[model samples]
Target: MGLERVIPVAEKLGVTRPEAKVLTVAGTNGKGSTTTTLAAILAAQGYQVGLYQSPHIYRFNERVKINGIEVDDQVLVEAFVRVDQARRDCQLSLSFFEATSLAAFLIFQQQQCDVWVLEVGLGGRLDVVNVIDPDVAVITNIGIDHVEWIGDTIEKIAFEKAGIIRPNIPVIFAGQQALPKAIQDKAQACQATLYAVNRDYFYQDADDGQHWNFASSGSTLRLPLGHLALDNIAAAIAAIQVSGLDVSEQALVTGIRNARLAGRFDVRQIAGKTVIFDAGHNPHGVEFLLKNLQKFMKNHDQYTEILSIFSMLGDKDINSVVKLLKGCILKWKIAELNVPRAASLAELNSALHTENNVEQFENIKAAFESALAEVKDNQIILVCGSFHTLEAIWECLEEWQ
Candidate 1:
């Protein structure tokens, strides 16, 4: 509902304003990766760090982590108990996101974390995580997803994300797209120093394509490549730099090399086949996935067939994303996800638009099994579309193991 509902419970739980340094990340994409990298770097610097992210791939414990380790079930259960009691005393109802976020705050507060890295679950201004004012607010990128909840235009979405900016704080805009005026105006109104990517800070591939360089007016760091995207890594570094935190160069490099998020461009060798799992359901995210896929292909042997296990939520822009990916995907194994917003077979077929290299399955496990059985030595199977799509396959793999 409103921030008022969660704020009171958070205050009652003694987590409304954490004593630790807060770095809040918000965007249409890259929020999870950026937050993960930030926490990893701070932890590498020997700080007690707490990280909170959303839409976990496998387990609920993945939502709350300390020192790069997912907290145990007992920790979450304890925090949830506290939050539930507080909410009951306040007589307020919370959505799953709001309740879990407050629980994360309670855990971080109890652990006495040195740094709190929070990922905004949705639009920034109204998100439960925004209850704590961030010392460094990072907007990884803005895209036209979540239009039904946020807005239909990029500017409108930017305005909602800009709600995370606070007075006299450092704001990092790392979106590759043009800088939205709404963000600039909000930064000005708040008197926050804005470090827009490609303007205040820059990143490029070094002489060796394997490594990259990040340069700002304050410092320059040559970093090793990691599992996440370079832009997100750079954004995390910039936020740390502006945060006035004491992070060593070694910590920066080591953390960059060590940081990993499960479903973003995740690769695995399963059943003698090359499989990639990504949670890119929107056009912008899919575009990023394609670029990384192209790079992977360039560095490795070409696959004779690129088969995709695809599904999407009904709210997403399925047509644009399908068209953007059609050029690279040779065949598609579409399945209907068992979620309230999942797309129907008819809707998926409409998006396909005469692409005959397609097969429909009743569920994700069957589609994945068919892909595994049919994939040959020279074939690559891509599991994508939504987080739900990847989560289904991951759960199935766990069961089989």
Candidate 2:
């Protein structure tokens, strides 16, 4: 929860100050998307980009990447060895996350990347990724997810997220909602140039659905739509425009089109039926998922019914998520996740007590398999609630393949 332990170790490893241009992203939601887009755009512009994201969906190697390629196991082993030696020399014990993050930093430093796009693992102030000073800071949005670790209120969370802002750097508040006072205050205190979405820059879905428009003070780009959210992509563009990088319009276009992350409205076909794998565990994330779901339903009107293979962590606001999704999901196929933080079956039952058509399973695989067998031509299945939930289904799909 604090940087006291990791700072000395980072110093010992000689990665305290990054040689590459750094963009550190902190927010409750959209951090992955923003970082992905940032890395893609930079790489598209021919820069050697190092992207470090947290809580990889399938593999630990997914956490550290250079130009969209995950580093090999040997590379990770070598980096971890170096990090372990550094920690032992400093006579400090690093948490699993702290140790892994320091290893990513070491890899990026050694690889001599032109740019580093770092995503804050948890709250921004003391998170391991905040060890490096960023050339540009990006706050995707302030939401209520990590209340126990951050704070109960939005302002408090915003304050923690604002910790990534450095003096005189360009900070982008890409939240669609009104700016949080904590963020405004922190930016002012640091004298950082703040760019709030819909204030200093804006993005809107094009009527054609194939393109979106981004407009700032002087530039407007009609970009091709990609799988990720527009707001996050817009934040990436805003960061690059102020990053002093030599990115052109073509790079921005190519990057937005290229950026893709697993479990983020990831639509695919399985068993001749459509399935959307989304890792939206919180209310804010679910709202975004619903918006995209609604768009998909509108375009493909034949898909009349929506079913879900769902479960969540016990710490999350499961009731709120169920309430948001209940209106659209016709049938809920749920199971208790096989994780330490998984919600209990009793808790899942209680949250979904009001639902009319609900089916409970012993595990995520059975629930997903049931949905696959029963889904009709005019129906679609949505696998969501937690990344662990998606991982369960992914294991099943991989075995079948």
Candidate 3:
């Protein structure tokens, strides 16, 4: 019954996908932001919500939250126990993501929650979380990531993320590309209603190309969502509207202003100089990071330096990552992460040697120190490319303190 038990219990329980009013989110990026935003809007509307996300920053409890508070460990343990008792011996080789997903499903079933925001782990269709039939399905910005399981091309990848769309449910999509077309095709095959940008609904950034837009029902607004952040906002808004959650234009405005998905271009100050931390590993996410950074820095026409600190899992394309970030970055802090999957310093060096301003380090702490030593106070330090990198930096900060 420990949190570790998940195999047979899940099978024994018969894949009991809850019949909750679910809002399942699947995409290459922005899943967290879109899910969290929907949960926040519902909570603001007084709905008891269960939000499940992935790859905890610090604690396992982060995957399950009720009303913005992570489920207590005791609750998690009890859910695991129930799953363990159900399985009893029918061994299912569940990954940690698979096990935790089942536990969350069971917990949501037991609770009287009004809505559940399910975050997809990998591909949408076969992901353990996909067992449930969602009421409102959302696909936010498709791209090429997780190739081993999801396939290679963006089209193949779209098929996987599109798996979140359930029959008869209303689906909202972003990322104006053929991927949305793939989702629409799947939705049509399932007889699901599809509303999308440039068709059913769309979003435009206000503040002269910086606000969000949701052009649904043939109307648009100067999306007052400022903070240099717009991650699947259009799709989220469309989903909310389709789900029959009545919120004024005011709530959307408020939520966008208040919503914050941690570790996605989140800005902070370690010792007064500006720093941005984003777990954007793949080329798609990197492209966005570079674009948004470039867009935001447009006013500072003066050559602003980029101090890029990075570490990543070995499976990721370190070379592609280097190529994507090469020109934009002013300097590089190539550090090795502690996790088993982390890319080695040697691998990073080989990837970046052809690029400019690149340096190697034993690990994250040293890289951070060296970057700090060389960068000017006005320059910005962007820590990115892996969640493990952020976790390591956080741990280092704790140790230093």
Candidate 4:
């Protein structure tokens, strides 16, 4: 639950500290994309990179990767053996996240990664990934999420997100909103150089909308857009530039073009239907998805109708998320997720509140199948609401393939 419990076991396993350059990223939404892009950039430059992320969409192996490839089962098994032995020696009970994070560190250490790109599993202060001090800490963005664990207010959440900043290390803030006072205070206390997105670095879509340009201080580069969010991609570039590493502009462009995460704005054509899978569970994340969807609609001929397969966790603000997308979503195919904290059909209906263009299914697979069966030409299907919703569809797609 706290560092006191996990740090001892990490030290016993020889992973309390890292020898590789560490870039720890923490945020409510863009952690996965940012970390993936960072790793791609570093790897493009020929550095052995280790990326550790959480809440894998398909397999547990997706949570750990070396040089853009998921670690093999034998690697994971070996790391787990060491972690289990260390935990037993320490006589401490580690949470699933803590134990897995230690295993990732062990793998990265044993592989002798040149750069370790880690995504904070939750709030930065007490999250298991914070056990290692980052050479350059990046806070992708902050929002009112995990209110129960972090805090109810934006300031409190930002405070927790800023916890990864160490004394005199460079800190990057890429949130859309203005800098929170909590982040300012923490940066000043740590004397970490702060780089706010708009003030210190900037990224803007080109007039053609095919490419984007990133500028920081006196240096600037035009790069091709990737499947991930351009803001997060730009932040990754900025983080690497500030890390004092030798990364060429060519490598930056290659990395951005190569960076792709499975669930974030993932678009595909299956059986001649356009389907988008986004893991935007909260209001802020949903807003980002809406923007991307609008752009997608603009690029293609306007669809006659937009159908959405949606479900969310019980703790999320379902009402707010549904409210945000109701205008664009012509019809809804709701499903009950199989997870413990999944929202029930009743909960989803109560949140809808008489919108009425809805059909309920027993599970996500059925809901997705129904959506696919009912699809007409020029109609788009959006599978979103939570990662679990997309995971079900992804598993189904894998099976079909």
TM-score of each: 0.98, 0.98, 0.90, 0.98
Clashes of 4: 0
lDDT of candidate 4 over 1-401, digit per residue (tens): 46999989988988867889999999999999999999998999999999999899999999999999999999999999899999999999988899899999999999999999999999999999999999999999989999999999999999999989999999999999989999999999999999999999999998877799899996988888888988899889889989988999888888888899998989998766789999999998999999999888888866757999999999999999999999988889998899999999999999998687999988888988888888888799999999999988888796444
Tell me, what's the RMSD of every candidate? Answer: 1.0, 0.9, 3.4, 1.0
Name the candidate that leads on lDDT: 2
In model 4, state the lDDT of residue 368: 83
**Which pairs clash (backbone N, Cα, C closer than 3 Å) in model 3?**
8-87, 9-87, 202-215, 203-213, 203-214, 204-213, 205-211, 206-211
Between 3 and 4, whose lDDT is larger?
A: 4
Residues 1-401 of candidate 3: C-alpha lDDT, one tens digit per residue: 12234434564675455555789998887788788888776776777889999878767787898878888988899988776656556654556676688788777767778788888888787787777778898888787777888889877888888887877889887776644567768999999988776777766655565455556683565667644346476667788888976677776777667666668777777765667888888887787778778865785554388898888889998788778888878888887888888888788888887776777788888888777667785588889989888877776665433
Task: Go through the candidates in order and give each one's C-alpha lDDT.
Answer: 0.92, 0.93, 0.76, 0.92
* Candidate 3 off by > 4 Å: 1-19, 89-93, 179-181, 208-211, 218-222, 226-231, 299-303, 399-401
Better of 1 and 3 by TM-score: 1
TM-score of 4: 0.98
lDDT for model 2 comes to: 0.93
Model 4: residues with Cα > 4 Å off, grouped in runs: none
User: Against the true structure, candidate 1 has what lDDT?
Assistant: 0.92
- Sort order, lDDT high to low: 2, 1, 4, 3
